[model samples]
Target: MEKKELQYIHSFEEYVNEFINALIAYSPKLISAIFILIIGLYGIRLINRMVKKIMLKNEFDPTLSRFLASSLLWALRLLLFITVISRLGIESSSFVAILGAAGLAVGLSLQGSLSNFAGGVLIILFKPFRVGDSIEAQGVAGTVNEIQIFTTKLLTSNNQTIFIPNGILSNGIIINYSLQGVRRADLVFSLSYDTNIKTAKDIVMKVMTNHPKVLKNPLPAVSVKNLTDTSIVLAIQPWAKNADFSSMSSDILEQCKDAFDKAGVSIQPYTIEASK
Candidate 1:
């Protein structure tokens, strides 16, 4: 028992000495790694903050700014981790090679995602439309609610939320109704063949001119669009701010009917169902 105890004590002393020697040899490298890690983390934060500020100053979307900053922060942290590992005298070349291979595999698997990311970048760089803008694109007409990294959300008139992938959105044609700041309501009014064209034109002009939403500067115009066997088509063009476009169009149509009736102007039996 005494002999075994002596052997155990000797083995413990050897272990302690070896451990002390290893610690002494690695202490400087460990300290250096820790210092580098601290400084690298701080530098990464500073860089991320600068990037966010620059994006904000450039009026970049909040969604894009945050996504980009977070992605960069994670990438810097990964690089710092690799650097610290390398500083500890560990062979990181194989690890780096493995990481590269993994990244390539991930890239291949996420090709569509990468395309979306690229498209999102393009969207942010080029301001085609903005949040709250009423746009018609991809067979979807709605107000833009949010622009995300991979998808854009739109709130429809009926209050349905839609998520459109950025990849397809960027590739397809976009119709921005609100970009022009004003929209023109083109309405065609049909009257009986025997109705007086002069009196009808005068009534439409007066109704459009009196409406508060219609722009007076452009001076609303009326033209004889078509002459069918049963009716005379009159085209009424009025410009209104986008926000008031739909309401103005509806109001103008209703008021035109009343004005025509009061003026004893005759309309086609089906003219009330005219399409705009």
Candidate 2:
């Protein structure tokens, strides 16, 4: 019985010794893995900050800056992840290939988005329109609020917000209303056939010329455009600042009405057809 008890104690001692050694050997590797993870995250943070600082210092466009910063952070994180995995005795080539293949599949799935992204790059480089500019593109007319990689946001005059794809906007013809700094308020006024055409033209021209908002450099004019059986058509063409278009248009209409009344000019009414 004594010999059996001594042999049992010896076996237990050996087992404990082996277990402790194994633990001691694994502790360094576990600590190393933890360190790698912590360092990788720290590097990512550092890279993100650096990229932000660089973008801010360069004064890049807000949209572009954000996009580039995000891309940079992802790229740095990928590199760090690869490094950490390599340190853990893992072959990174297969992992990289798998990531590449996955990326390709996703890219194929988002072809339209990729096209818009390409279009957005061109837009940023060429700068066809800027923020706050009133533009007509892709059948939408409004003031540009923001330009992004996939779309552009606009706020219309009626307080409606619209989003247009960047691909369509870039490819289509964009009519920038605010580019010229000035616009023409083209209006047509008709009068009865009995009214003196020359007298009405003179009165309208005088009113437009005296208006303060009307630009004098382009030389405003009022001329007879067409003569129908019942009325004579006159075109009032006046150039004014873009910001003053609406107010000037209103003023011109009111002034013309007052002038015509004072001059005893008669406005023609629409003729109604009688049943046969």
Best-fitting candidate, scored by lDDT: 1
Which regions of candidate 1 are displaced past 4 Å?
A: 1-35, 55-71, 88-92, 266-276
Listed in order, each prediction's TM-score against the native is 0.79, 0.73
What C-alpha lDDT, on a 0 to 100 scale, does residue 185 get in candidate 2?
75
How much does each candidate deviate from the true structure in C-alpha RMSD? 3.8, 6.8
- Give the per-residue lDDT of model 1 (tens digit) for 98-167: 9899999999999999999888877877878888898877888899998888888999989999999889
Compute the lDDT of residue 84 as modeled in candidate 1: 97
Off by over 4 Å in 2: 1-90, 268-276
Q: Rate the local accuracy (lDDT) of all candidates.
A: 0.88, 0.82
